[model samples]
Target: MRDSFDLIGIVMPSLLQGATVTLQVAAQAGLLGLVVALVVGSLRTTENRLLRFPLTVYVEFFRGTSAFVQLYWAYFALPMIGVRLDPLQAGILVLALNVGAYGSEVVRGALTAIPRGQLEACRALGIPTWVAYVKVLIPQAMQRVVLPMGNLAIDLLKGTSLLSAIAVTELAFAARQTVSAFGNPMLIFGLVLLMYLVLAAPIAAGARYLNDRTKRYVA
Candidate 1:
């Protein structure tokens, strides 16, 4: 037990450093993913088949594939085509694209759930299309989608662990390194699991809070 405590004391700092990297990747990827979700989701709602069809393909391709494969492709395969990205960049890009593909559906469903009559009402009032979307439609749609977006953010946070496979040096990678050195798999990995719970707790709480607030506001 004394040796285990000493080992933990030695490993915790490195683990924390890796956790910081994990947080950074997840935060940046989540923000980028939200932007992708908004643009792709909005494009998908248009009547222009030209725009919609390609966006549809983008969404489906990401959703259908494994994010691990995507990350590996970006980090490994892209170099052959004269496109090389470092591990951090590759990890962020893959996480963003993967979560964005899933979140796009949330955006689309939220927007589509709005009553057509509401849009027609804006039209009757001679509101410009963009203005109607900005002032009325998007705000309401955003409220409805907030909870799902939060859920996506949590999933993205968890997904950052996969970055270890590509040598991103995030928490999981740090834990693996510690385990190899200390030869205490249970102590290292169990702590790693607890670290993940620590990271995930606030996101889940924030989402629940937003969900309640949105429900109250909608009421």
Candidate 2:
């Protein structure tokens, strides 16, 4: 018990630091992902085949491939082609792209799910296409996507563990380093799980709050 306590005392600071990095990565990635989802998803709803085809390719490619591999390709392969990103930048970029692919579907579905009559009414009122999407379709879609986007947010949080693969020193890396130094995988990893749970709780709560609030607002 004393040894475990001592280990915690020794490693807690590092873990906290790593948690901070994890939050940073997740925040940047999640925000960028939301942007990508909105752009791609909104465009996908268009009748324009030119935009749809390439966007479809992007969504399918990222969604179809492994995120871990994508991270490696960004960190390792990109340098060979004369594009280099630091570990933090690579981690954030790949995660944003990966999560964005999934999020695009959520946004697309939410947008499409809006009642057709609303769109028809917009057209009938002489609303421009961009105005209709911005004022009417997008807002309603955002309300609908709260829960799913929250799920994606949590997934992005979990996905930060992959950053360790590139030596970014986030929570999983901190845990791994602690385990290497102290040799108690079970205890250290167990704590890591708890830490992740703690981190994820607020995202879940915020999503629920938004969902409930939006539902009330729409009602």
Candidate 3:
């Protein structure tokens, strides 16, 4: 057991290095997803059928499908159609699209949750709609639901494991490679789990801290 642990430790640094890849994927995906979410959410709030119609279809299509299928489409289908993408690009794109679908709803709901009076006040004060949204609505909405976004961030972090299926050399790929060579699957998986916890714990803590601090502000 001690020898097995030592073997796991020997390769752990390599696995940790792979975590950098995981972090890169998740960070890019979450940021892009939030951007997508904000756009779609705002559209959903508006009365425009033109903007709402296409955005609805996009959100539904993404939300309806498995993220793995999207990843496959990115890595495989696009190439078959003569639009090739590298694994990293495909991974990030698919992750962003998938998370964005769900994030859009969160964003829409958050945007809606802001009091109507705030919008009216902003308008009466001669503030631009964009300024009102940025300065007042988005700040309050973000404060109201930091936890959910944090969960999405954590979800994307875990979802990076799926990129391994596309031969991306992220943590999941590194774990599989080490396990194959070492013949100790348990130790390899344990290390992988640990690495995921290491990545996720801080985001969770930060979410809680922000929540607490924001409550202090509101109070």
Best by lDDT: 2
Deviating ranges (above 4 Å) for candidate 1:
122-136
Give the TM-score of each candidate: 0.91, 0.90, 0.89
**lDDT by residue for model 3 (95-128), tens:** 9988998899888887778789998999999999
Pairing residues by index, what is the TM-score of model 2? 0.90
Backbone clash pairs for candidate 3 read none
Clash list (residue pairs), candidate 2:
none
lDDT of 2 by residue, 106-190 (tens): 9899878898998899999999989988888777876889999899999999999999999999999999999999888988899
* Candidate 2 deviant stretches above 4 angstroms: 122-139, 217-219
Off by over 4 Å in 3: 121-136, 216-219
lDDT (CA) per prediction: 0.91, 0.92, 0.88
> Native-vs-model 3 lDDT?
0.88
> Candidate 1: what lDDT?
0.91
The predicted structure with the larger TM-score, 1 or 3, is 1
Question: Which is the leading candidate under TM-score?
Answer: 1
How far does residue 73 in candidate 3 sit from its true spot (Å)? 1.8
Candidate 1 residue lDDT tens string, 15-80 = 999999999999999999989999998788889999999899999999999999999999999999
